[model samples]
Target: MNHAIDSITDGTTYRTGNPEATWRHMRAHAPVHWHEPGLFPGFWSLTRYDEVKAVLRDAETFSSASGILLRPLAQGEDPGSDRTLALSAPARHSALRGAIAQWFAPRNLRLLGEHLDGVAKAVVGDALAAGHVDFVTDVAAGLPVEVVCAFLDIPVADRPDIVAWTTDAFCAGSAEERSLAHLQILDYFGELAEERRARPGDDLVSVLARVRFQGALLPMEDVVLNCDNLLVGGTENVRLAMSGGMLALLEHPAQWAALREDFAHTAPTAVDEILRWTSSATHVMRRATRDVVLGGRQVRAGDRVVCWLASANRDAAHFPDPDTFDVRRTPNRHLALGAGPHYCVGTQLAKLEITAVLREFFTQVGEVAPAGTPERLESIVVNGLRSLPLHLTPRTG
Candidate 1:
């Protein structure tokens, strides 16, 4: 138990130790265990489904403005706090989300869906042509960035740099590297935001540039920060979910066969189950605004509360045989995209991208299997595969 608790703050533990086993131990023994100070700071670790969901739901009591990671922060506050959508208070968060909501609305997503179908087809076709490829880089990594960059009207040439920066920002080994990556992204978007302001276009950046909240244009810093947030959020989880989901399918052949047999009928449920199985976002942190009792533990005001979404998604009390990767899982109320006010704004877009790739694979792929070992990312924040070498056989009529 102490080992598990200690591992909660160590990113390497996610790669070396069986994280599911650790979470299982916590769920069964200490659903709301307090993590003692180590790499970052001591915080309450919430693993059970109900408790995790409760914390996410009560945004008033548990705030996001302070910070949302296990990493140490300057003065215990995120620099983007109260400004960026992901780190803002309720009122500001709502306003910021509303400003860009149209971009991810049903109509926009439907249009993007049509575009993604073509992107997925091309991406999958290329993989099948290669015969052997790293699925993470070749297949899973391409679609989300395509969708996001296209939606934002980012020039195709600049996307590679954007992807590189985003990867470093989220998965870099050192704080300096991560901070530098974030600064680079901010600087890039800051320049783009200015261009969008000069000559507005029908894109996310333009929307951010021109949007007025309370009859005043958004600050430049806010625009860039939100752009950074959307881009990172748009690319990271969807890619991870796709990679992890593909791994799950390969591991569970019967489930893959069942999905292939009736993809249209099963895809919706399959996407949800994949999201649950991957739980790519891993955990989200919130600051307790007031002292609250959680799982028989008294959490103090200003205390950091970490809700383990990955653990919650695997709790047997919520989902029967939670460890099993069932594509057809129904009644799956997963907190993968999160819950309540801070729910992922790009939920519809993510599903469309995932479904598009799976549909394309089903259409073009015949036999698919691992070519080499799959390498998992060693990050406490992101549950992702860094690489997955795969061999693909084209479908035969």
Candidate 2:
């Protein structure tokens, strides 16, 4: 089939700079529309918050069985994979969710808090010293990778390689490039897994190697897939979330000032608000298992649905003023971390990260404002600032 590809419809190509205007246009006219980009079959872009929630919450009707990205990921998945857990629906997703759930709980990461604090302090301090710095690099992007490193017990110094592999593997700009990055990452992981087997360490990988589920320790391939999931789901998205939170603060000075005044209670709310405002990850893809009606539109059994968290977060029907960046926005049930069985595993870690970064930021710098308008992440799956330049006014001592 010659897909009706309006190549320019891709948000990554042109929407990288100003997503709001693009989303606004999407909501206004083509809210549940499709546009092929020659790479894959087009999909329905669900624009309203209720509509997205309807899909995510009701996984049976709108399933992730087809996977999330625009194009089909190569079927090179190692047989014993937690990705089987992640990409499967119903029974498989439930089992996978239960297996990984306790691993990322607050109680599980209790021993990790102190090291995380130190990491946040180091990055925030570096940014402060630079006088002016890219928040994405100095703080946001830097912190999560370290935290993931902490979780995996990888050396802090290995961040460049870890971040790079993930960037290439998951953040590649196109289907063909992503396909290539996938093979490379899987190869790198194969080596890493072999090394961990020979010389084990005190990290998630070692623990995962030992952890049992459904009568036995998971297969080595599952171990690798889980690590890949942690690599993809944990690092950059949280970095972008924190960066987006900072950008929200920069754009809404009142919210920023409020958070500065009361760091304890206010910082957490700011995290939720940022999720509401930014939607760092723009969309998650799902396949329709059966025919259904969403927002009054009939969806065929095999249809692909792109749940636009970007559009959903700003749906006026759900959020009052829908467009305002209100840090204290209450009843904020945004789809930032998604919902149901596949909700993010690193939620607590992410919250702690945003809180820690904001604490160090407000305490040390006093004032932080954007040096330029936000630039979006150049991928459809994740939304973030490619470079968030911020000028932090020094605290009067």
Candidate 3:
């Protein structure tokens, strides 16, 4: 355990570079090992596939409310802990969860998807017309912002700021930078809330404001939380899914070519394999409510536990030749969306967006290759390519 802690603190990007081999060593030798970092409080790093599922399933023992990610925000920083309801206790998490659940329900999402497809088609059309472009910005990044904006009923002019808020809020930002961005977003949402009150629209927030969840109409903070959820969870995950999926395809062009040739069939499986491959959002943290044993170590009440989704996705115990970028791999039970109540609420929407990008790109353009070396995102939580300089050839139709 002491040795394991040293490696994690030293710095390791499990998804990029050589961390895959390093993770294999850890999983085989120490599936559940306590880790400490200089910049952050140490947590238990769960590497094995099964162990991660166990922690995810039994939320009572290993609570999401405990913590969602690391940093405990470094030394001498202002206080930061598990404050978001999404990462809080069951009762508190449930209240916000219940209100948003209806908004993301299958029927509701189905209605959302209808609008989503139109947006997807439009974006794809624009990308194809450009002939040569940076696929991430021209296509992937724009897709979710449009969908999330439509869902929140935010005007098109302000959609870019919504994406900017998430970049500043959820991922990493300076104390001053994060604080300022939070205030700006809150002010924006507050105005929108007022607009909805005076003239309710068909948007989710307007409906949510009128909703009586638990006892009565959900409060402003809860509404804001859901708004924040829509703002963050709504677009970013799908954006990562599209960007990461494109990266995976670039890395494995044989599969990418295969997908391009017959997108109607390979596109769906490509989405699954893409999500499994990316496992963006890396991991979610939980606190040990009581003394418990995992991977042969004892964890006490105050200890933070980290799930290595990035590692688990490539776990040899679960994924065969886990490093291979094979889209056709069957029985891929990778925990990309996670398990239990905390599973991504936007899974369906992500799939649609991903599929649309792939099918449309393949159908409209070809000769896709790296224009320059792609840059990796610096975030510990939101793993992705910052700029994927992909060059595409005009399609001959």
Best by TM-score: 1
lDDT of 2 by residue, 1-397 (tens): 1121232235555344555666666666666666543355757777767777878888888777657656533443234322445576686666666655676887877877887788788888888888788777667877787777767777656667776666656445676876776666567666666677768776676665655666676677767776777776787778788887777776677877888887787777778888777677777878898888876677888888888787788888778898788777787888888887677778888888888888787778877666877666666667777677888776778
Task: Work out the TM-score per prediction.
Answer: 0.95, 0.84, 0.87
Per-residue lDDT of model 3, residues 1-397, tens digit only: 4554344433334334555566778888888876654457767889888889888888788887645666544433222233344665777666656655676677877777667677777787776666655665667777777777878888888988876765565433365787687778878887787678678888877866666645776566556656766667666777777888888877776987788777787777778899988877777778888899987799998788888887888987788998888888878888988877677777777787788767667766757767777666656666676566767675776
- Give stretches of model 2 more than 4 Å off: 1-9, 12-31, 34-38, 72-84, 163-185, 195-202, 210-219, 367-374
Against the true structure, whose lDDT is highest? Answer: 1
For each of the candidates, the C-alpha root-mean-square deviation to the true structure, in angstroms, is 2.0, 4.0, 3.3
Better candidate by TM-score, 2 or 3: 3
* lDDT assessment of candidate 1: 0.88
lDDT per residue (tens digit) for residues 152-185 in model 1: 8899899998878876776577889988998998
Ten residues in sequence with the least summed lDDT for candidate 3: 75-84
List clashing residue pairs in candidate 1: none
Backbone collision count in every prediction? 0, 1, 2
Give the per-residue Cα lDDT of candidate 1 at 62.
96
**Each candidate's lDDT (Cα)?**
0.88, 0.72, 0.72
